[model samples]
Target: MPAVSIDINMFWQIINFFILVFIFNKYFKAPLMKLMDTRKEKIAAEFSEAQKNNEDAALKNKEAQKILKDAKDEATKIVQLAEKKADERKEIIISEATVQRDKMLKSAELEIQKMKHAAKKELEVEMNQLAVTLAEKIIKENLNSDLEAALADKFIDEVGGVK
Candidate 1:
């Protein structure tokens, strides 16, 4: 059987390896891991903030579009209202003009009727005078006032009565 040999150098090497692992864990490995974790958290926070900003921008754009559409609708309504008012005004003016024209026509007709009545009265007076003269000429004598009036009445009765 071969003899197994244990060396003191192997024990020292094991102790040295444990000391190196401890130093690395305390000084370099723990700080490096902590720095990596901080960097990851910062990157995550930045991404979240960017996403929130994007959502807010989208909301603002939608609100702006809605406001523009409402303005256009309001403008259309205003134009329609103005046009309706204009049409109403036009109709009112036309109706007023028609009323004025009708009043003028009525006034002219009344004036014409008054003139016709006055001319008829004048004609009647002339006819009565002519009848009195004709009666005097037929009798070959000047008539008194009472006789002239009677002759005039008789002449009027022989013709149709005045209107």
Candidate 2:
């Protein structure tokens, strides 16, 4: 066989490489790269928005718990105030009842005293009339002077002894 001859050139190799790079960039590389970058940006924005929404929800929950605790404390205070007022009213009612009972007892005692005074006056009048009638009968029957004096002294003694 004859000796082989080799002919290699760096300029042609460089030209072929540039042509291949241009063809690939125009056909497929630019659009695929743009789509991937846009997708990555949208995912990052969504994650950031989700984190902000979670923070807002946590703050709202804390506010709600504080409001609920305040309402419960207010309700308890109102109930305690109402109980105190009820107790005060009960005390007032009891005091009024006691005053009324005392007044009634006092009036009843006064009425009893008045009745006793009227009965005593009636008894005094009746006893005086009976003594006068007995003295008149003794005088009409003509008793001796000594006996009459004795009977009058006895009647006087008996009347003086009465309450």
Candidate 3:
């Protein structure tokens, strides 16, 4: 090497710079780096917790969807069962109504037959009584004006006073 020129002021500045760096490192660097590491750990913990909560929310949503689908299917089944019961009830009611209508018709026919039989019996009794009375009167009366008058009066009475 050639002759080295040493500057005394530059050498003193370099020494001062090293001392300042050593003081800064001893006093401030460790706590600052420790604070930065603590902050990083806190951020990571929060992010992981948030991701866990998001997964839980997704699971709950899927469960809720399954519950809703089950409810809808149960409602459909209940409606179908109700319709079946109603149809059966309707058939039962119709059958009962038909039976009641047939009974009423049969009762009305029996009543009509009884009424006709009663009317025929009353007419037969009246005819027999009138014939017996006529024979007795013809035997008791003279075949003259009294008989003719009696016959005419009976005829007028039987005809409801219209002669």
- Local distance difference test, per candidate? 0.84, 0.85, 0.84
List the candidate numbers ranked by TM-score, top first. Answer: 3, 2, 1
RMSD to truth, every model: 8.6, 7.5, 7.2
Candidate 1 is scored at a TM of: 0.55
- In candidate 2, which residue ranges exceed 4 Å CA deviation? 1-25, 133-163
* Residue 109, candidate 3: C-alpha displacement in angstroms: 1.7
Compared with the true structure, what per-residue lDDT tens digits does model 2 show for residues 1-163?
Answer: 5486434665677788999899889887988898999999999999999999999999999999999999999999999999999999999999999999999999999999999999999998888878766765665466668777678767756765563
State the lDDT of candidate 3 residue by residue for 1-163, as single tens digits: 5487658987999899999999989998999999999999999999999999999999999999999999999999999999999999999999999999999999999999999999888887777667656854664464457777677557646753332
Model 2 TM-score (2 dp): 0.64
Q: Model 3: runs farther than 4 Å from truth?
A: 1-18, 130-163
> Which lDDT tens digits does candidate 1 get at residues 98-149?
9999999999999999999999999987887677567546644555577785
